[model samples]
Target chain A: MTMKRLINLKRTEARRIFITYSAVVIAYVIFQVMSSSGFLSSSMRGMLVPICAYMVMAVSLNLVVGISGELSLGHAGFMSIGAFSGVASAILMQSTITNAPVRLALAMIVGAIFAAIAGFLIGIPVLRLKGDYLAIVTLAFGEIIKSILNNFYFGVDAQGLHFSMLTDTTRLLKGGRLIIRGPMGISGIMKIATFPMGFILVMISLMVVFNLVNSRSGRAFMAIRDDRIAAESIGLDITKYKMMAFVTSAALAGAAGALFAMNYSTIVANKFDFNTSILILVFVVLGGQGNMLGSIIAAAALTVLPEKLRGFSDYRMLLYAIILIVTMLGTNNAEIREFFTKLNPFRRKEEA
Target chain B: MTKRIFTCALLILAMSSCAFGAPFKLGGTAPLTGGAAIYGTAARNGAAIAVEEINAKGGDIQFELRYEDDTHDAEKAVNAYNALKDWGMQLSLGSVTSKPCEATAAENFSDRIFALTPSASSAAVTEGKDNVFQMCFVDPNQGTASAQYIGEKGFAKKVAVIWKNDDVYSKGVYDTFIEAAPKYGLNIVSDTTFADGNDTDFSVQLTDAKDKGAELVFLPMYYQPASLILAQAQAMGYAPKWFGIDGMDGILTMEGFDKSLAEGVMLLTPFNADAKDELTVKFVAKYKEKHGEIPNQFAADGYDCVYAYYQALTQAKANADMSAEELCTKMIEQFTTMTFNGVTGENVKWSANGEVTKDPKGMVIKNGAYVGLD
Candidate 1:
C-alpha cells in the first residue's frame, strides 16, 4: 500500500513537470508564429527576451523564498556580479570565440560560477542569521555591491585587462577599450542575447528547481524551514541544505542576469538595485510560494502588464499598483482562494 | 457589450484619423516623471511650441510630435523607441538624457532611423552613429572651449579643477580641459574629485585650491553641486573666480538659491536667455508664458533641434509620405552639409560624425540675470 502511494505521488510529480514544460513550449511556438507573421507589436517583441529572463529570476528566487521559506533581499547583487563578469568574459573572448551561441554559453557559465562563489561566501555568515536580520544583512550586501560597482573601472587593451577603483587609474596604451566605467557602467556592448537563449535558460532553471525540490536535500530545506529544532533533532544538516538552496538560487539569478545584460546595448549597476530584488520577491509571493509554474506565469504577466498599460500613459504605473494590491488581497483572502479552487476542474476531479 | 463595441469603434476611428494625417510622425523619449523630469518637460514644451509654429505656417514639413516617458532609464528608453517605431515614426528626437540617448542611438543606427537629440551632451550618444546628431555641444567640446576661453582671455594664470569624477559628463569635460589647458598657457595648480554621496561638502577641495594659490576654480558639474560648492566656499572665505560649463546654466533660477552667490559666476552656454536677438526674444517669451519660468539651455536646444529639422526637411524637399529609411538618408545628407540658424546659435553646422560645430557664448550672472561676457 505504501509503495502504491509512493508510485502515485511520483506519477503526479511527473505530470506536473510535463504540464509546465508543455506550457512553456506551446507559448514559445505561439509567440514565434505571431511575431514572424507581424501580428505582434514591436514593443511586445522587444520584451520577449526580458520576459524569459524575468521568469528564470522568479523561478530561482522562488526556490529560496518559497521552497526554503527564507526571505532574501540581495538577489540582485548576485545578478549584478553575473552581469559584469559575463560582459567582461564576452569581451575578453571576442576574438577567440567567434561563435555567438558558444560565447554566450561560456559567458553565462562564468557568470554563474562567480555568482555562486559570492553566494557561498555570503551564505556562510548570512545563514547564521534568521528572519529580519537575514533580510537586513542581505539588503546591506546588495547596497555594498552596487557601491563597489559604482566605483569600479575595467578596461581592455593590447596589454590585456586592467582594473581600478575610485578612479580611472587604468591608463591604457593607444586603442584601449573601456569595458566598464564607474557610475556610467558598461556601454557599447554587443547585444547577443536572443529569445531562444532566454527560453532555454528558463527551461534549465525550472528543471533545476523542480529536481532540487523533489530531492532529499530539498526536503531537508523544507524540514528546517518548518521546525528548526525538530529538523536538527532528526540529524538533517540544516546549514548545508540552506546553503545549497541559496547558492543554487544565486547561480540561476546570475545566469538570468547574463541573459538580461546581453539583451541590451548598455547596462549599469543601478539597474540591479534594492527595487529589483523586491520586484523578484513580489513575483515569488504573488505566484504563491513553492509554485514554480505560478512564478513563471506571474513574472511574464507582470513584465508585460506595464507595457500593455502604455495606453494609460502617465497613470499606467498607478493603475499597475492598484492591480497588484487587488491581486495580493484576493490571493491572500481565504474565501477567494476557496472559490478559485472550487472553480478548477482538476481539483474537482481529485475531490470526487 | 454594446458599450465595449462602441469604445472599440471609437478607438479604430481615432487610429484611422492618425493614419490618414499628412503630418510626419516624429517620436522621442524623455524622463517625463523622474528626477530629470525638468529637462524632459522643458524639451517637450520647446519641441511642441516649434511644431505648432511650423504647422501653423502650413509648410510641407508638418510634424506630429509624440514624446514618451522613459523615466531616465536606458531600458525603458529602448522600449519607448520600439513603441515609437511601431507608431510609424519617421524622424526621431532620440532622447533627452545622455544614457538613454546612447541606448536609443544604437537602435536608431541599426534600424536606419535618423535621430536628432536636443540636450544629450555625451559624446557616446553620437559616437560611430552617423545618423544620430546632436544640437548641444559634446562634453569634450565644452571642456576644450572652456579651457580656450579662460586661457585666451587671461582670466587667471593658476586655475583649479573640482569635478564629479563618477559622472561621465563631468569626467569627460575634465579630461579634455586638463589636456587643453597646457596648450593655452593655463597652469592647473590643484585638481580634486568628488562622487555622488560625498559631493555635499567641498571645503577640502576649496581649501586645497586656496592653499595652492589658485585664482580661478573650474566646476564641470551640474548646478546643484555647484551651488553648494559656491555657498561652502563663501563660508570658508575662499572666494575664487568661479567658472562653469553648460551644466551650470540653471544656477540663476535654482529654487531657494541665493542669486547673490551666483553674481559674476561665468559659464559657457549655447543659449543665453538674456540675448536680444529676435528669435531668442520670441522663443523666450513663448516658453516663459507657457512654462511660467525662464527657459534654460535645454529648452533652447530643443527649440533649435526642431528648427534645424525644419531647415533640413525643407531644403531636402522631403515630404511627409516618405518612409523613415528614405528620410534617414535625406536627413544624413542635409545635416552633414546644411548650415542652420536657430535660437541656440547662428550658422550651426553638423559634421559627418554628428557633432555640432557652433560657438558657445560666455555669460556672467549679474543681479540674477545673465549678461553677455563677450
Candidate 2:
C-alpha cells in the first residue's frame, strides 16, 4: 500500500509537469502562427515579451514567498540592479561585440551574477530576522536601492568609468559616453528581447525552481518554514537553505529585469518602486502559493486582460478589482469551494 | 435567392465604405482617469474642440480625433500606439507625459507615424526620432530662458536653488540653472535639495536659504510641495523673492492654499490666459465658454498641436487622395521650413530633432491669477 501511494504521488507530479509544459508549447505555437498570418493584432503582439518577462518574475518570486514561506518585498530592487548593470555592460561592450544576441546573452549573465552577489550579501543579515522584521528590512533595502540608483551617474571613457552624484560634472571624463544619468535614468537601450528568447528564460527559471523545490534541501527549507524551532531541534541548517532560495530568486529576477529593460528605450528608477514590488507579490498570492503553472497563467491573463478591456476604459480598473475579489472568494470560501467540488468531473465515485 | 442578394448587398456596402474617402483620423493617448486626469481631461477637451472648429470650416479632407487612455503608464502608451496603428491612424497628437512618449516613440517611429506631443518637456522623448515632435520647450530651453530673463531684468545677483532631488523634470531644470547662472552674472549662494512627494517640512532648507542672505530663491518643482514650502516659509517669517518655472502654475488653485503666498511669485511660461491680444482673447473666451474654465498652458499647447499639424498639412499641399505615408513625408518636409503662429506663442519653430523653439515669457502671480510680466 505504501509503494502504491508513492507511485501515485510520482504520477501526479509527472502529470502536472506534462500538462503545464504542453499548454505553454501549444499557446506559443498558436501565437506564432497567428502573428505570422497577420491574424494577431499589433497590440497583442506588443504584449508578448512583457507577458513572458512578468511570468518569469512571478514564478521566481513564488519560489521565495510560496515554497520558502518567507515574504520578500525587494524583488524589484534586485531587478533594477540587474537592469542597470546589464544595460551598462551592453553599452560598454558594444564596441567589442558586434553581434546583438551574443552581447545580450553576456549582459544577462553579468546582470544575474551582480544581482546574486547583492542578494547573498543582503540575505546574510536579513535571514536572521523573522516574519514582519524580514519584510520591513527588505522594504527598506528596496527603497535604499532606489535612492542610490537615483543619485548614481556613470559614463564610460577610453580609460574606464566616470561616476558622480548631485549633478557635479567636474568628475566626468572628456568625451565620455554617459550611460546612466541621475533621475533621468537610462535611455536608448537596444531592443534584443524577442518572444523566443523570453520563453527560453522562463523555461530556465521554471527548471531551477522546480528542481530546488523537489530536492532534499528544498524539503529542509520547507520544514524550517513550517516550524522554525522544530526544524532547529531536528538539526536542519535553516539559514543555509533560506539563503540558497533567496539568492536563486534574486538571480532569476535579475534576468527578467534585463529582458524588461531591453524592451524599452528609456526607463527610470521610479518604474521599479514599491508599487511594482507589490504588483509582483499580488501575482504570486493570487496564483496560489507553490503553484508554478498557476502563477504563469495569472501573470499572462492579468497583463493582457487590461489591454483587451480598453474599450471600456473608464471602468477597466474597477472591473479588474471585481474580478479579483470574486476569484478569491470563490476559491477560499468554504461553501462555494464545496459547491464547485461537487461539479468536478474528476471527483471519485465514493467521494461524490 | 434571398441569402445571395443579402450577401451581395453587404459586400457592396463594405466596398463603398472603403472607396468613398474616409475622414483623416488622428489618435492620442492621455491619462484620462488617473492622478493626472486634470491635465489629460483638459488636453482631450482642447483637442476635441480644435477638431470641431477645423471640421466646421469644412475643408476637402475632414479630420477625425480619437484618443486612448494610457493612465500615464509607459506600457499602456505602447499598447495604445499599437491599437491606434491597427485602426489605420498614421498621425497622433500625443502620448501625454515623457515616459509614455519615450516608450511609444522608441518602437513605433519605424511605422512611419507622425506624432507630436504637446507637453512632454523631456529632451529624451525625441532625441533621435525622425517622425515624432514636441510642442513645448525642453527643460534646457526653459532653464536658459529663465536665467537670461532674470539677468536682463537684473532681478537678483545672489540666488539660492532648492529643487526635488529624485525627480527628472526638477533636476533637469536645476542642473541647467546651475550651469547657466554664473554665465548670467548670478551667484548661487545656497544649493539644497529635498525628496519630492515625501517631505512636507522643509524648514531646514528654507532656514539655510534665508541664512545665506539670498536675494532670490529658485524652486524648480511642482505646485504641491511648492505651496507647502511657501506656507511654511511664511509661518517661519523667512521671505525671499520666489521664482519658478511652469511647474508652479497650478499653485494658485491649490485646495485650501493661502493665495497670498503666490502673490509676488514669478514663473516662466509660454501661455497667459489673461493676455489681451486678439487671438489670446478669442481662444480664452471660447475655451471658458465651452469648458467653464480658462485653459492652462497644457490645453493651449494641445490646441496648438492640432493647428500646427493642419498648417503643415496645408503647406505640404496634401490633397484628399494622398496616401498616409506620402502625407507624413510632406508634413515632415514642411515642419522643418515653416513657423506657425500658434496659440501658445508666435513663430513656433519645430526642429528636426523634434524640439520646439519659442521664447518662454515671464509671468507673475497677482491677486490669485497669472499675468504677463511685460
Candidate 3:
C-alpha cells in the first residue's frame, strides 16, 4: 500500500509538470499564430513579453513565499539590481556584441549573477529574523536599493566606465555617453527582448524552481517552514536552506528584470519599488501558495486584466479592485473549492 | 436568396459609413489618480472642454479624445499608449508628466504617431523625437527665460539657487539657469541641493542662502517642496525675494497651505488666468464653471495643444479617415511651418526639433492672486 501511494504521488507530480509545460507551449503557439495573422490587438502583442517576465517573477517569488514560507517584500530590489547591471553591461558591450540576442543573453546572465550576490549578502542577516521582522527588513532593503539607484550615475567614455554618486555627467569626460543618469535613468535602450526569449527564461525559471522543490534541499526548506524546531532537531541547517531558496529566487527575479527592462526603450529606478514587490506577492497569494501553474495564470491574467478594462474609463481601477476582492473571497470559499474539484475530470477518476 | 440580399445590404452599409467622416481619434495618458492627479485631471478637463467646443463648432475638423490613467508611471504609460494604439488613435497628447512622457514619446516616434505633450517640461521628451512636440516651455528654455527676465527686470543681483537634484525636471532647469546666470550678470551667492526622501526640512538650505546675503532665492522644484521651503523660511525669519518657475504655479491652491506666505512671490509661466484677453477670459470662465477652480498653467497648455492641433489639421485639410501615419506626416509639415495663436501665447510656432517658440510671462502673486509683472 505504501509503495502504491508513493507511486501515485510521483505520477501526480509528473502530470503537473507536463501540464504546466504544455500550457506554456500551447499558449506561445496560439499567441504567435494570432499575432502573425493580425488577430491579436497591438495591446495584447505589447503585453506578451511583459506577461512572460511577470510569470517568471511570480514563480520565483513563490519559491520564497510558498515553498520556503518566508514573506519577502524586497523582491523588486533584486530585480532593480539585475535591471541596472544588465543595462550597464549591455551598453558596455554595444560595440563588441553586434548581435542583439547574444548581447541580451549575456546581459541577463550578468544581471542574474549580480542579483544572486546581492541576495546572498542580504539573506545572511535577513534570514535571522522571522515573519514580520523579515518582511520589514526586506522592505527597508528595497527602499535602500531604490535610493542608491536614484543617486547612482554611470557613464562610459574613452577612459572606460565612470561611476559616481550625487553628481551629474560633469564628472565624465566630454563625448562620453551617460548610460544611467542618476534619477533620469537609462534611455534610448535598444529593445532586444523578444517573446521567444521571455518564453525560454520562463521555462528555465520553472525548471529550476520545480527541480529545487523536489530535491532534498527543497524538503529541508519545507521542513523548516513547517516547524523550525523539528527541522533543527533533524540536524538540518536551517540557515543554509533558507539562504539557498532566497538566493535562487533572487537570481531568477533578476533575470526576469533584465527581460522586462530590455522590452522597453527606456527604464527608470522607479519602475521597481515597494509597490512592485507587493504586486508580485499578490500574484503568489492569489495563485495559491506552492502552485506553480497557478502563478503563471495569475500573473498573465492580472497583467492583462487592467488593459482589458480600458473601455470602462475612470472606473477601470475600481472595477479591478472589486474583481480582485471577489476572486480572493471565492478562492477561500469551501463550496467554490468543492465545485472546482467536482469540475476536475482527473479528480473524478481518482474518486471513482 | 433572402440571406444573400441581406449580406449585400450590410456590406453596402459598411462601405457607405466608411465613405463618410468621423471624428479624429485623439488619445492621451495622465496621472488621474495619483500624487500628480491634480495636473492630469486638469489637463484632461481642459482638453475635454476644447474637444467639446470644437465639435460644437460644426467645423470641417472634430476630435474624439480618450485619456487613460497611468498613475504617473512610465511602464503604465506605455501600456496606456498601446491601448490607445489599439483604439485607432491618430494623434496623442503624449503624457502629462515628464518621465512617463519620455517613455511614451519614444513609442510615438517608433510608431510614427504625432504627439504634443501638455506639461512634460523635460527636454528628453522631445530630445530625439521629431514627431513629438511640447505645448509648454522645455526645462532649459524655462531656466534661460527665468534668468533673462530677472536680469533684464533687475529683480535682484544676488541670487541663491535651491533645487531638487534627483528630479530630472529640477536638475534640467538648474543646469541651464547656472549657465545663463553669468550672461545676465547675476551674482550667485549660494547653491544647495536636495533629493526626494530628504525634502521635508529646509532650515539648512535657507540658512545658507540667508548667510550669503542673497537678495533673491530661486526655487526650481514642484509646489510640494516649495511650500515646505516657504514655511521653513518664514519660521526662520529668513525673508528673501522668492523666484520660481512654472512648477510653483499651483502653490496657492495646495491644501493646508498658508496663502499669506506666498505674497510677493514671482514665477515665470506662459499663461496668466487673470489676463483680460477675450480668449483668456472665455477659457477661464468655462474652466471655472466646469472644474470649480482656477485653471492652472497645465490646463492652459492642454487647451493650447488642442487649438494648435486644430489649426494644423484645418490647414492640412486633414480628414478623419486618414491613417495615423499619414496624419503624422501632415502634422510634421504643418507644425513646422504654421503659426498658432492660443490662450497660452500669441503667434506660437514649433521648430523642427519639436520645441515650441513662445514668450514666458513673469507674474507676481499679490493679495492672493497672480498679477502681471510687466
Candidate 4:
C-alpha cells in the first residue's frame, strides 16, 4: 500500500508539470493565431517580446522572493549588468559571426554568466542579512549600478577592449569602433530578439524555477523561510540554499535583460533604474509570491494593459491605477481567496 | 432576444460609422503630461490650430488630428505609434522629444509609414530611415550656427561651455560646439558639466569660468536651469555674456524669474515672436488667442510642420483613394524639393536626408521680451 501511494504521488507531480507546459504552449499558439489573423491589435502584438522578458523576470524573482523568502530590491541592477555585457558581446561578435541566431545565443550565455558571477559575489556578503537590511543594500546596489553606467564608455576593435569613465581618454587600437557613449548609451544594436526567441527564454526560466521549487533543496529553502532558527537547528545549511536560489534568480533575470536589450536600437542606463526594480517587485507581489503561473499571467497583462487603454489619453494612468487596485482587492478578498484556493494547481495532497 | 438584437444593431451601426469616415486622419505621440508637457502641449496646440484652419477653409480634404500621450517614454511612444497604425493611420507627426521620436520612427522601418517630427533635433531621429523628416534644424547645424554667429560678431574670444552631461540633446549640441569653437577662433577656457535635475548650484562652475577670465558662457541646456544659473550669477556678481540654444526661448516668461536676469541673455532661434511680417503677425496673434501665450519655437515648428505636409500633398497632387503607401512615396519626393516661407519667418528647405536648412536668427532679451538682433 505504501509503494502504490508513492507511485500515485509521483504520477500526480508529473501530471502537474504536464499541465503547466501544455498551458504555456496553448497560450502561445493562441497568441500566434490572433496576431496573424488580425484579431489582436498591432499594439498588442508589439508587446510580445516585452511581455516575455517581464514574465521571465517575474518568475525568476518569484524564486528568491517567494520560495526562498528574501526580498531583493536590486533586480534591475542585475538586469542592467546583463544588458550591457550581452550587448557588448553581440556588438563584438557581429562582424565575425555571420549568423544572427548563434550570436544572440552566445550573447545570452555571456549575459547569464556575468550576472551569475555578480550575484554570487553580492550574495556572499548580503545573504547573511535578512529582512529590511537586505532590501536596503540591494536598493543601494541598483543606484550604484546606474551611476556607474552613466559614466561608463566602452569600445571594442583591434584593441580587444577599450574603456573610459566620464572622459574621452580611451586608447583604441587601429580600426576600433566605439560601442557605448556614456549617457547616449548603446545605439544601433541589432534587433534579433523575436517572439519565438522570447518564448523559448520564458520556457527556460519557468523550467528552472519550477524544477527547483519541487526539488529537495527547495524544501530546505521553504524551511528556512518558515523558521530560520528551527531550520538552523535541524542541520540545514541556510546560506547555501539561499545563495542557490538568489544566484539562479539573478541568472534568469540576466537572460531576460539580454532579450530586452536586443529589442531596442538604443538603450540607456536610465531605462533600468530604481523604478524598474520596484516595478518588477510589484509584479512578483501581485502575482502571488510563490505562484509561477500567476507571475506569468500578471506580467503579461500589466505590460499590455496601459497600451490598450491609451485611447482614453488624459485618464489612461488614472484608469490603470483603478484597474490595478480593483484586481489586487479582488485577488485578496476572502471570497476570491477561497475560489483561488480551490483552483491552486500546485496544492499538495494533504492540502487537498 | 429583442434586447440582444437591439444591442447588436447598435454595435454594427457604430462600427460602420467609424469605418466609413473619410477624413484625412493624422496621428501623433507626445509627452502631454510629464516634465516635458510644456513642449508637448505647445506642439499639440499648434497642430490643432493648423488643422482647424485647414478644415475651416473647406478644401476637398478635411484633416483630423489625433494624438496619444507618451508621457515622454520611448516604450510608451512606440505603443502609441502602433495603436495609431492599427487604427489605419499611416502618416504621423512622431513624438515631441528625441528618445520617443527615435522609438516611434523605429517602427517605420518599412517606408509604408511616414513620420514627421516637429522638435526632435537629434540627428539619430532620422538616421537610416527614408520616410522620416524633421521640421527643426539638426543639433550640429544649430550648434555650428551659434558658434559662427558669436565668432563673426566677436562677442567673446574666451568662451566657457556648461551643459547637462546626462542629456542626449545637450550633449549633442555641446559636442558640436566644442568641435566648431576652434574653427571660429574662440577658445574654450573652462569646460564644466552638471547632472540634470536638482543640481542647480552652479556657483562652482560659474566661479571657475569667472576666474578663468571667460567673457562668454555657452549654455546648451533648457530654460529652467538657465534661469537658475542667471540668478546665481547675479548673486555672485559674476556676469558673462550668456548664450543659449532654442531651449531658452521661454525663459523671459518663466514665472517668478526676475526680468533683469535675462537682460543680455541671447539665444539661437528660428522664430521671432516680434517679427512684424504678415504670417508672423497672424500666427502669433492666432496662437496667443488660442493658447493664452506667445508661441515658443516648438509651437512655431509644429505650425510649420503641418503647412509643410499640406504643401507636399499639394505638390504631389495627392487625391482621395490614393493608397497610404503611394501617398507617402509622393510626399517624400515632393518634400525633398519643396521650399516655403512659414510662421517661423524663415525660408524652409529640406535635404534628401530630412535636414532643415533654415538659418536661425539670433535674438536677445531686452526689457523682458525678445528683440531680434539680426
What is model 1's DockQ versus the real complex?
0.46
Candidate 4: the clashing residue pairs are none
For model 1 chain A, give the 10-residue run with minimal summed lDDT.
Answer: A1-10
Give the clashing residue pairs of candidate 2, or none.
none
lDDT per residue as tens, model 3, B1-374: 99999999999998667543699999999999877888898899899999999988877788999998998988889899998999899999999999999889989999999999999988888988889999999999889999999999998999999998768889889989999999998998999988766889888899999999999999998888999999999999988999999889888888899999999999999999899999999999999999788888988988988988999999999999999999999999999999998988998999999999999999999998888888
Pairs of residues clashing in candidate 1: none
Q: Between 1 and 4, whose TM-score is larger?
A: 1
Can you tell me which runs of candidate 4 are displaced by over 4 Å? A1-19, A171-176, A234-238, A339-352, B1-21, B196-200, B235-237, B252-263
lDDT of 1 by residue, A143-191 (tens): 7888788889999999988999987899988999988888788888888
- The ten-residue window of minimal lDDT in model 1 chain B covers B15-24
Model 3, A1-352: lDDT tens digits are 2344335457777677778888999999999899899999988998999999899999999999999999999999999999999988998899999999999999999999999999999999999999999999999999888888888888888888888887774466788898998878888888898988999999899889988888789889999999999999989999999999999999999999888998887788878989999999999999999999999999999999998988887788899999999999999899999899888776637564
True contacts kept of each: 0.53, 0.66, 0.58, 0.51
> With candidate 3 superimposed using the best TM-score fit, by how many Å does residue B209's alpha carbon deviate from the native?
3.8
After the best TM-score superposition of candidate 1, give how far the Cα of residue B272 lies from its true spot, in angstroms: 0.7
RMSD of each: 4.9, 4.5, 4.7, 5.2
TM-score of each: 0.91, 0.93, 0.93, 0.90
Backbone clash numbers for all candidates listed: 0, 0, 0, 0
